[model samples]
Target chain A: MTENNEYAVECEGLGRVYRSRSLLGQSRETVALQDLNLQIPKGTVFGVLGPNGAGKTTTIRILSTLLSATTGTARVLGYDVVKEGREVRKNIGIILGGDRGFYGRLTGKENLRYFAALNHIKPRDTDRIIDDSLAQAGLADQQKTLVEQYSRGMKQRLHVARGLLTDPGVVFMDEPTLGLDPLGAQELRQRIPALVGQGKTVLLTTHYMFEADSLCSRIAIINKGKLVALGTPAEIKRNFSSIGVIELTLNQTRPSLQEELTGLDGVKRATTSADGVYQKLTVHVVAGADLSDKIAEVVGKDHIENMVARDPTLEEAYLEIID
Target chain B: MRNFFVQAYLSYRGLFLWLNWTAYISNVVLRPILMLLMFALVGKFAADSDAAQAYMIGMIGYAIPVILLGGILQSFVYERVFGTISFIYSSPGSRVAVFFSRGVLHFPNSILACALSFLFGWLVLSLDLSTLNWWTMIVSVLLTAAACTAFALFLGNFTMMLGEFFNLYNAAMGLFLAMTGVIIPIASLPWFFGDLANGIPLTHGLVALRGAFAGMDIGAVRDELLLEALVGLGYAIAGIVVYMLVERDARARSSLERSPA
Candidate 1:
């Protein structure tokens, strides 16, 4: 693939295969990613959503030049990730958010200073740049505290600050909000648009459907190392907009209830999950299907406590695509 | 150039947790001194004052490799364990600067350990200082510590690749103690073992150190000192080559964050 100005990140037929040999001389190969093609436009938040082990991190690692692709090519800001790795690295920042990346004994500011040096930031500019990044991540007040003493949310924010130390044009964030409270996640989610405002293209991988829906201008859903769905959140949901959902909270349920509902005329898929003393049954149907009366008859109205009908959510749409 | 020193200082302070006053005094200072006294006393009980002095100088030579090797290896090990090695590899920083900086603080630390060991030998073991050539002794100590630090940097790549710090540390310590004439004269060993000893760092440096303590001039042990310097340079070059190769392999195999199981 050749470099393109319009796209901040590009990949063509990208694939990665991991091979391992056992002590007993047995070998196994795992295809973490394969034939993955993506062209993320400049100055946009491109979200990649995938289930666990779906190669989201593999993609990030390759684009960040941390791992080379086994086959095909990837470029960050027109630099080939493999052949021109140094140039690629110079123009991109990576944040693999987790509790493990920081030196616990070092203060947050000291850690940033070390990484700043690693990024080749000049000594004269290091403090100013670090201060700006810390303030941007809302970590200025706690910059002097040891990282081990910081809460998990604070560590995550520090990861973001570190990634922006060089002010790279493209940033790759792998699960930046994986383990945070609702408030902490919300605070981080709010920081995404500001990055775009600064004209930085962000490629974010997340498991949160709503976060993707709200923040990403375009989202790609990958499964089994392949791009299964790609579109704006609304467009993705629009594809499944013709499907309606009917939910029933019942006092009890039998194993046959799902099979019985799946056999209904307009029912596309049926699933049941237990919540405390109640069994919640969700049925997907074609638009305008009024199967509630028939479902009540099948389930027996005495066993049903409540019923509601609604349009499919982004999460529901994502589940349908993945399934 | 400034970035190199900044990285070296920050990494040394950040990764080497034992730099705290308590751990430093206990692990770095007291531990080595106590070991030196114990071994020198053993020699005294076994033979006489001359034997004890030999053992004391030998133990002093051994102290540099132990401190320097462990310090350098621990830096690499902590980088891996803390998962920061991936960030370092992923950056656009100069690999030369990053690689060599790991030894910057460690070299001086090794020198300090050597000085402490000598002080303890004089104060506790009653090692004679009158016959010591201060100038040559300083040169020997500096060269010996540099050689040991370079050797540690060479082995540090293995610590990063294998993720078995203690295993490599113990094996290296064992090899140096037995083969580098730390306690035994290399000449007395088998011819094959002597040949092996020629390749290990500090073997010649220790000889030059003993020569310096015997009041020999730099000209007298010049060959050994030169050989020591050459050995250190060889290991340093070998270390850089190994690091580049391992880095390439890690990028290919996606194993930079941790060693593959």
Candidate 2:
């Protein structure tokens, strides 16, 4: 058990490698997470941001005691994740998103009652705990409805309610708002701070930069099984303050233009996207470097309709780090 | 105890896909009856009424494993398919409670299947029940169901480990039908098969059941009953052990969410 209560989650040199063997007896190994370290403080919503296959889910799995770390140690709420798994499990709730993790035939309330029993909630307190969780997730009225009949948003809300059944001190949510409508996503996002306000620590993994920027107190961006950046959203953006983005609207796009812009000195990345009759070019460059002359030379000035230069957003910073 | 019953009922209702009245009636009720009728009719045509009566009782014994195995296996398979097995493992719940509760409802379902087979034999085939020792017969059926359920739970671990559901189910069903003296007398078989029958569930239980139908007293089949209960207990303990081993292996392989093929 951890001696410090300030941090709800702590890991040092944590690593995991998956090995598989083919029918022909050839073996291969893939490193899913490598020498990763994180310390999440109590009562905060810490976000983990990464590209696909970037070890986000792997980290969550190790911390929640669903998988063991091959190398180092992880502690959750003062309990070792591997050695004291039951204690860790008792203090944590894991919400894996998607439509698959529920019993479609059972009503939402019945599902909660069943899980409550699995958590060994006192029989006398089961109903009240379930009711409080349902009301918290804003699904109190729809509790009796079969989960198969629920909309995706309702199912996601029910997932939230289920995670709260034990009233765990630490909650791990993986892409909680994935596949939700804008309004539904917003509603779920609004509940995060309320959880933190009640002294619960939340570890969230998401791909949405705007969502992380708005809700997370700190964010870690990992790529290819490595942590590339970690800090507050503003601090992450500020680390790239020396970076600037130039957006240009063109009448037409040519493949050669992208290569030409990327070849320019001080240019980090040049990407093009088609929007209706025009094309949008986003160029990331060093802040002080004057690439206007070189860019104008690559594409004729007459073809340039709109141009704007500004500091990079968190999304742009994440893209640059991932690249 | 509350958790045990709650988990049992919810898992059966949620994970068993054949819970609907129509599917339940067709699969659990009609299918077993059809099997009993077909086998009894074949035996009568092939030999005589005495042979037909033997086949009917054999079918009753066979129904225990058939119903219990499918019911218990389906519960584990659907839990993997629906991706709830990880939650079950990650919870702080007692593993013993969760493990045993899976077979709770299935045990009674198998007993119910046996009773239906016995009823069909008595009413349609004009089988004599007046000579049957009702007490011993009931105990035999209960013991048979318990033993088969325990064996099925033990087999259920392989479905998750091997990642194949129906293939394993078919293999086990074939093994039980052929090796457990379901339709054949162990004495007439080769010596090796007779020894094999001793380890398989439903073999001794069926013998005791037949003895009960012949109006034997409890003392006459006491050894068989004790062996049947011991077999059930052995499988139950083995199932729990194998479940913990599988849980450990799943954590090592990180394959809890990977469903059986």
* Candidate that would win on lDDT: 1
Task: Give the clashing residue pairs of candidate 2, or none.
Answer: none
True contacts kept of 1: 0.81
TM-score of each: 0.92, 0.93
DockQ of 1: 0.74
Candidate 2 docks at the CAPRI level of medium
- Interface RMSD, one decimal, each candidate: 0.9, 0.8
lDDT of 2 by residue, A114-190 (tens): 89999999989999999998898888999999999988888888888888789899999999998777887888899
Q: Candidate 1's residue-wise lDDT over B7-41, tens digit each?
A: 89989988786788998887679877987998898
The residue-by-residue lDDT of candidate 2 on B1-261, one tens digit each, is: 987899999988988888889988886888788888998998899999888888888888888888888888888777888888888888999988888888999888888888898999999986667679988889988988888888988988887666656888888888877777777888877769888778888988988998988999778999998888889889999999999998988888887767555
Regions of candidate 2 where Cα sits further than 4 Å from its true position: A240-242, A246-263, A270-282, A287-309
Model 2, DockQ value?
Answer: 0.74
User: In candidate 1, which residue pairs get closer than 3 Å at backbone N, Cα or C atoms, i.e. clash?
Assistant: none
